[model samples]
Target: MNRPTTLALTFLTLTLAACGRPASTPAVSTDDTSSGSVADAGGHGAGGNGAAGHGDHALAAPGPDRSRLPSRAVLGPATVAPGLRVQTLPANVQPNLLALKVLILSSGPSDYGIGTARALLDQSGIPYDVLDASRTPLDTAALIAPDGSGRYQGVILTDSALIMDAGNGTYPSALDSAEWDTLFEYERTFRVRQLALYGAPGSVPEDYGLRYVAGAETATTSLRLNAAGQAVFSDLKGAAIPVTYSYTYPSALQSVPGVSTQVLATDPSGRVLAATSTSADGRERLILTSAQNPYLTHSQLLGRGLAQWLTRGVHLGEHRRFLQVDIDDVFLEGDHLTSALTLTAPFRLSGSDLLNVRTQQDRLRSNYPAAPNFRYALMFNGGGANTAVPTLCTNSPWLTRDLLSSVARCLNTQFDWVNHTLDHQRMDVMPLSTATTQIQQNLSVGTKLGLNMSRASLVTGEHSGLGFMDPTDDGTRNDDGTAGPKQDLGLGRSNPNLLSAAVSSGVTYLASDHSVASQWDAQCPTCGVPHPLNPGVFLVPRWPNSVAYHVTTPDEATAFYNSLYGPGGLFPYWDRNLTYAEFLDRESDQALTHILNGTPFPHFMHQPNLRQYAGGKSLATDWVQAALVKYSTYSKLPLNTLRWDDLGAQVRRHTAEVKASAAGTLSGTWNRSAGTVRLTSSAGTVPVTLSGASSGTLYGTDRAARYDLSGSLDVPVTPR
Candidate 1:
């Protein structure tokens, strides 16, 4: 006889795999002493002559003129820097119709100017058009609208020489008098905004009224923000942001009369590092010390803040919350496997097993009666029951004929099929060819079985094969709960070959094993929101939970504890005998920590979770249900079960919206009318919570049974 579901839950040890290697040394170039030239950097036209009318000699050179320049206030000759002077811009109601488009001015290929600019903008999901000012010069036709209406609302100058001649910088070519006049005239007339990351000496012309004096080269600098600066630097408000510039330069501003200028940040010596200015035409201009890379948090935040400022609290679309729950180690059940091994191995759960699992899943649906579907991502390993043909069972009884196919048909149609690898091998240990082949082979097998396994999500076998996060404890087990000697598996470094193989196999969202490093952040490669980590690949992580590797009876549990926690054992302080109740308590605590973060909940489980043991005889279903119950009761927000791919897509869109929206802006508007709750957002997708509508029919802009923000911006929820 089996115990009731309530009492069947038990604690499991953390599941971990170990591989050891020396830590890798990051490559540091001693040769990058100076910024690359625009010509050498590969800007579109560093060496070529620009379009016919925008040539260098198109107009005669003009003498320097400062009569119309903004008033200059030089207070930096003193010891201590004055309070930050920043002019915050008012919210612009004139919506940017071309919110996705931006103008990128680069002089050379991957030059620090354009290269750094591209990296910053890549994660914002905003598209851009590049005009290599070096090769093709800027003329009145390109800078000003034919009908006097500006063609571009904003411009990012990677190469400073675009507006003025920075002889010592990347592009040495100076713009003609006509070009310079055209550029300044368009900005002042059209109110087009601009962000200048860096400039060579004399690069900032008097027309802009900025005196930039290049400082000594340094690797790092501390940047302090002021009150006015906080409003524009919303992401870094109330906090000092440290910036890393390959070559740090100290600069000062010559305040122009009648123009509002504010200092956003100051350097260590009390010099202005970042500042914003407002033109007479109400246009905004931002200048930074140097071009920053996206790898740094401050840099990413700066890029996002700039986008929101330029767009004035608008994004690609609305916002939507995504939840992706993955069930790992799905395989045919086998006989004689240890309870612990079973959790990680296979079991021949007959077709009836599928039905019973479905029955328990239905129970979960009952709680959210209004939700149209409950789905799971089955992360499968392909080595189980390897047959010449795609057969599930090859025994005399043939308990599971065409097992995977039948199982697929029985599962909820919305469930996702993820590739867990062909033989469940640690991808990091295998050769690139083998790793690539394993993923491809598994995908092929699933397709042959009509499983329609997608290549989007890869849950690398055994503690994330390409190790991004390794357990903090030593690899050995002890008698007490205390750990053994600390172990280090050179997992800190990313494997380029393995990543390339994963990308080739069509993996976009790769799962990571979460750590307690941060309250909410887990250890996933380039985790958090989607950025340009590996082009299209987005790394996602699962909260860490203790794993069970063996079946445990009260006596076995005692033995298990004594073996690992007893005196001189791996861990010596733990209780000699661990109870099932204690296990559940610990698991609950771990799950709660993550749930409170209120982001996506991607609880992971393995095959043995469905074993007849591990409490409740349906360990997998029991664990999942337990999680759902906790999430439903404790989370402040509503929850939706989405496939892994869909969840990735949602994150990508949400990141864009959050970057584009102003601080404290709500996702969208919800209007309840005629017994229907209508949802709408100017952004992309809106995650609308529908309470007391468990029995309601959710309708999106389309007629889909489920309510997904991607399908339509406006979704109507009506009672069934």
Candidate 2:
């Protein structure tokens, strides 16, 4: 085939894969949650597997009303040489506008993802970054908010991005050389991160005929109150059936069309035990029943719910939302009062002694109950290898294992774990190989502890490892010989160090600090502290209310602070340098102390240190528990962890079964219909018709954008 023909055919297949739906399989079994609300998007009777495909190709001019045509057009036939890929993005979706960052979540290197995805993106010209998702649990603030890109829309997830076969067409979440290379071949890689649609909260009553809360998610776990209130859990994917007393958490994912909710199960203490979407069905309800009601002895209450509703796309008149900030990290290092309150020295140690240090450090919990609705976060403020000791984060293996084990049980109830890196290296400066190793180590540690997640979980920043990194990568090293960090974090600019690290390692969350919390009119523009890399920085008045970490000395503390009662300052709390005594005395003494000024004090500060306040057998457990309470109290919204693409699995499966009323491809019937463009082949006709310009850009929520030739294909579906 001529290069043009070949390119056209190739584009066709890629477009089909990109624009096609119902490609992914719903992993959750039928009625797995008891409501039996599963759909076959593009599959057979059962949910169909996610199969990538190329679609019809053929170029055309931009249609007058680009919004109406198929932004995603498929090529005619594979043999005819897959045609070129095409996309028609809404003008609202900017090439530089926010909406293309994807956080890939996976378990231990998923299969054949990066390579195939990268090849297509290269051929299709999409932008993205991949990170190892299986590093830490998906329940931390520091881990998920590393660069602050967590706010992006539409996070596309694939487990492990590995190419090795594990189940069905499924592969582990790991990657090899081919996948990495594919990524580089795609569109120019930029540091701009897009947000993922955290499960479009609440089903559209108009679209799905259901009324559900937005951004709600659910999972299941069992707690046995068998021994003196010590919580032991049954595997989430595994149901504990001891004899006839089978404990099944039949989760009812919302299947009905119009009725919706944010229902879930809670343990005895009102902690989120398992997340359930729908209500019970007749003889088909998911009942997490233990012998007698284990309510007191490790029993749970299956109906606690938070509400998160999306306010976008709706008419401005319908806009209404509560204050629910989804936080992932709030780290405190050394004596920086905040850090001292959050992080403790000798941080990454293990055993009883380490537990003691943590115990003493944990008094931070005493700060919890104070900030009820503050955005939440998972703490990774410290505990990586001691840089001077290099091997510290590595050597103190327990730093991860023992700690995570303790943390997981806690996480089963409170918040999600935002996985941070294994060794906290300044990603921008470190060698890619070393960065990979450090991240891999972190993933390995997560495995031992059983809190599986991808590099996407880590909320990271430019100042990892040997100090800060240069986001622009001018090749100048830091004063410490590391990649010279940036002095100016340009406006609306993000750090590439964290971006590259996240995508390469399959990380999901980016580290970022909210510059201010008040409206521009409320404070001085130049007063809020600048980001570490960007000096004399002024936060865009639009998004304020940010509290960033990465302080070891007192000086950094004062930069953001406004003495005691300044109107417009960086944080709502005292300087990180403040002593615990000062924190206590000054906080309540001076009604408007810096303590009460900036974004509210992270709930963690209110609680005691992970170990100090709460006594976990190990520091990790206490850390996890502290993180849980902090998040539970703060991330006040309901959460749905599945990626937007994952939801397509159901739609993809059902769509695959759909046979176009007309046999043959869109190209076969080209020229037959008034607007028809077709190509005839041996078996059937392939046609692509455009009422207008089918050539346009299809922009993803995350920065990745695709150009499709299909005038937006109009498919009408009657709501069930």
Candidate 3:
């Protein structure tokens, strides 16, 4: 029943020799008319018929449901041919060390469940090895090392039975009887847990106490966790997890002798979707009857729980949400629009505006418990600031220069500040002396203004000097804003003058635009790439939002947005124009994805967005509030708001860990009895993240400690 549709249909066409069932109808339908949509909002369609829409207009019909399902017929136990033998475990055989790694057993590369499992491990920085059962042989040697040490701490199966078509209308186990026995024996001997990503009820290799009730559930269904589920998935605080557009099998747990089964998740009908079965032999397994892919929201929500349960809350890697916003062009006047929707004079932040931003930040921290640490990072061009103004408490409608400068000086430590060059000059083609002066003069101005700024971080005007666009073009051209032809000559062609100037100016982390594909690190997704021309400098990328840098009010921003992404516009995406609220919904949805993915890249905007356009409302605050509200809906974990220097250090450590993993130099062993984890690396420093562990920086519920593992290091663990 767990085989593919074509194989299941073929099997149904033939009469079963064991059961005298008629072969007149197919076990599973191959019709692809299932309504489902993949959107950021709940990962399902907004309309009633599973169609997505913006504002009031309905989108086109959704495509077929891509989720795979099991056959309807009840399957029987696998037939072990003559001469096949089941191996017995040796008595009193104990292994010294089991490496802190997971092993994924899959039918082949095309298995959908593999991607879902890999996505969770990859984002969390956990190391794993995948073995294709259809191609590679699984034996005791693969599971055990020569020193009698177990190879993996956890075992994950892509499917419960590993059933696949064996030509001529026959579906059989890919592992065979002897291979299944070997895997089970190792699990029993080492006391390791196994997890099945997708399962169908009935005994092939073993029974999970699940009896099939229904299949092919394509509608969006809400699943509630029971007491056991709450213990397994302690991080998820939401009441219900929505499973959308998935081929889920609702089953009932049948009582079996010498086996205890606990229901984890159940649908509205009270049928089980996920459950754990502990056999009499001390082997435990968790099986989920729903199919999942990496893109599905249900998978993203449940993947971490599966990994944590399998590893007994001890694994190398950590996942924490972060939301850091960087307001660029601080202390500078930004161009804005008038009430008539026309370009007006540039505006600087008044005392009222700065106070409003502070009030909004305080409100956000108080309102959303998950984002209590939220704070903005100011990327300042100090040349526009008036340093002569004394720090004082001024009344409303004070002198424009005095109001802004005094308030900024008074609240100097409220926000994280970084140098954005002195006069906002583009450094792509600037001379070496000019670049050095721009970098040094800004530090001087920031110090004079009494702002606590970091000398190691730098954001050049327009992310210039990164060699993203044409190197020959002068700074006057605006290529990224307009749809003009530009060539990215790679980071190798980057301005050596700017790199040298940055190195000399004590800049270690130079900001780059994430929109430029070449600017980000290819090896590590959330890490900063080292500059090709200069090894001392690293390029940390920033995410740009849809909100225009100049627009202040919602109406002005909406007009500017529709002009670019509306119907028959320059870069049209939606069929019709969208209001400001709808635009925020779309933008916040994208932001939520990055936050959930654990990316530490700061989102960048400009100064005009801080202006108080309406009663207690500004474009920047509105955007942040919307994203925070969306985040509160799904998770209760605290969002980490790291400073620019801390973020760069984190990225550097992540890059080292990635390199160490690729080289296979990092190794860890968790001692269950002693409740400690020993980590060692043959090379440089690497980050070791352990759940329920002490002696590290506390992020959310987990702790991550960095170790220069040129030697073996042991850390105490609680083993949650």
Q: Output the lDDT of residue 172, model 3.
A: 60
Tens-digit lDDT track for model 2 on 376-409? 2333322332222111212244544444335342
* Whole-model alpha-carbon lDDT for candidate 2: 0.25
* Model 2: residues with Cα > 4 Å off, grouped in runs: 1-415, 454-457, 462-486, 489-501, 508-720
Which residue runs of candidate 1 sit more than 4 Å off their true CA positions? Answer: 1-323, 332-352, 367-372, 385-414, 463-492, 516-533, 549-578, 614-617, 632-637, 656-720
Which RMSD does model 3 reach against the true structure? 11.5
Put the candidates in TM-score order, highest first.
Answer: 3, 1, 2
TM-score per model over all chains:
0.43, 0.28, 0.82
Provide C-alpha RMSD values for all models, in order.
18.5, 26.2, 11.5
Candidate 1 lDDT over 1-720, as tens digits, reads 110001011111221112111111111122232332211000111221111100000100011111111111011111111223322222332221122245677644424455446544444433455786547766655643333334454678753444322333332333444454556566665556687755432323432345556544455666777886666655344555556433444567666665566777777777666777775556577776544433333444466456545534322331122345566655533222242323322344444444455556666677653233666677776665333433332222354444544555445243577887776554444467877887788888677556656568777664334333223422232111212211223333334556677889888876654431221121111125342335665656454333332322323333443444345434343434345555444344334333332346476654444444432336556545555554444222344667777666655444444343322222322222332333334455543333213343332211112233532344333321
Cα TM-score of candidate 1 = 0.43
Model 2 RMSD in Å is 26.2
Model 2 residue 281 lDDT?
Answer: 20
Output the number of the TM-score-best candidate. 3
**Candidate lDDT values, in order:** 0.44, 0.25, 0.69
Ranking by lDDT: 3, 1, 2
